[model samples]
Target: IEGGLLASPPPHQYEFARLNLTYVITSKRKLAQLVYDHKVNGWDDPRIPTIVGLRRRGYTPEALQLFAERIGVTKSDSWIDYSTLEGCLREDLELKAHRGMAVLNPVKLVMTNWDEVMGVGHLEPCSQPALPHAPHGASSDAAPEGTEPPPARHFTIGKEVWIDREDFEEVPPKGYKRLFPGNKVRLKGGYVIECTGCTKDANGLITEVLATVVPDTKSGTPGSETVKVKAAITWVGVANGVNAEVRLYDRLFLDAQPDAGGKDFIESLNPNSLKVITAKVEPSLANALPGQNFQFERHGYFVADRVDHVQGRNPVFNLAVGLKDSWGK
Candidate 1:
């Protein structure tokens, strides 16, 4: 009312601006409560999207940049559909990650003809050198602008490895494609092996699977033959492989809108979100630095844990995500 008498800017002007921003639900106080209650850890918990967390979750640097670009620079509070995030993520993954074989739930493999076919401890170098392909350069194709090429992987591979225990079913399910009695599935990145038999303990739990590697189907070799099969299983060599604990982590909450419903956020916690197990990794992974990323072939993308992964004694990996679309539903 007294415009001419207002000699200086009002002190309360900045405070009014603060009030508008204060009502955002992603408020620092609310987020801090989630952390204090262990609904999540500190912001860098692998479950969150802070840069460090994303890095630990095996998110490539390029993927994050792409996500920001797709969302566009905006000041609106509208909900961006989750599919937008997945599309950008998958596009970056197609070329930035290499495949390595790992069995999350291991079932033993006993080569009956180990002495006859190849003497026990007669190690064969099972390796896939085709991965870690060089990025297409300035004049060539395949290079994306402002994105650094993925680092090379020098991991080893093998024969006579452990398959996931769930891959075998004595009584077949409707669409199962793995080791059942007298069934055949291709050992991924390795060979075609037929499950001739299995050994079980008194409790009816499978002790081991006896399978014979198909003689002429080593991938990429001249004489390779493609076997007609629905399932291809993953494995790791027993002789030269590295034994590590793999931690599979999924979405922390079952509900996409976790803080909704007026219920305690912890109530929406997914009990099966995390599972830790001693598993096998390729020998070359034994030298991985903390936070290095790799796609564990059929399993998921994983990163060496910053807190618990030991380079030699007992390596720990955190499963970043599976290779399919199963998020924010």
Candidate 2:
């Protein structure tokens, strides 16, 4: 068999290399089964371990390189936890990714005091640093002593802003610092608001949270830094926010080693792996181009879907990964 094609001898042959990334299967037959059986959306699904999938999920080239360096060359087969890759991505993006607000599970927050300050239908100006931790045009240590920081970029606010539903609690849990009756919280890049109460529907679901804005507490304004709050929350102005479809991608399999011990991998499929939700994003995000990545403050890193995103139309985003300390063991 080896001598049949001697006339056209191969120039070079290389040994096959393998990566032992945990919680992912790289078998060609298994991957084909996943696509054909429709267990996953497709071969490029963000939940899969394919290169195309990783690219679509906002994995950067530098991050992948860092991962390879950390994993190094090894003769023996060994497994690396998925979190190692996630950490690499975080390190790569921490300094580069722009900061933006996106409320995945939004709940209405009506500023009852809005009309008092800005008048009815008026849009209030708000600003936030494009990159929160990193200084603009200068490295953090290079800034001269006693010099003020650069101003943040501005956005608009209205009578209402949408906050993550999880930020509020009808019954406060221990150490909870977010919104509740009489609790004051600063809206990131906006004003400090004191929760008066909340309105509920017949079904006992919170319809809208009513809050009164603290006087002269708009961020960057006089007295803004003086008024301290235990918690600061992210929000998107209802009038200025862009509605987007965000897909939260979690682990495909619940078991860490699904194929270990001769177990059938299909049986370990996680049913709640992908969740589609409508998110309220900042107006700036409306112009997000395909493959643009952002850190959705307090939520996770997400990217505009390269395949489905369309400018000036409804945009689709996929979650890349959450904060390192976000998940519980």
Best by lDDT: 2
Candidate 1 residue lDDT tens string, 1-329: 27676656644532211111111124466666767877666776776545666677677768778877876654444455444654566677655555567777787786566456555556554556324443542432234677654443334333467778888888889987788877878766566778878888999888898887675666666666657667777778777677888877776667666565475666777877667788887766776678777778776677888877788776888877667767654
Worst 10 residues of 1 by lDDT: 15-24
Clash list (residue pairs), candidate 1: 126-157
Residue 314's lDDT within candidate 1 is 65
lDDT of each: 0.67, 0.85
**How high a TM-score does candidate 1 get?**
0.78
Query: What are the per-residue Cα lDDT tens digits for candidate 2 across 69-124?
Result: 99887666677888999999998888768778999889899999789877889987
Residue clash pairs of candidate 2? none
Clashes of each: 1, 0
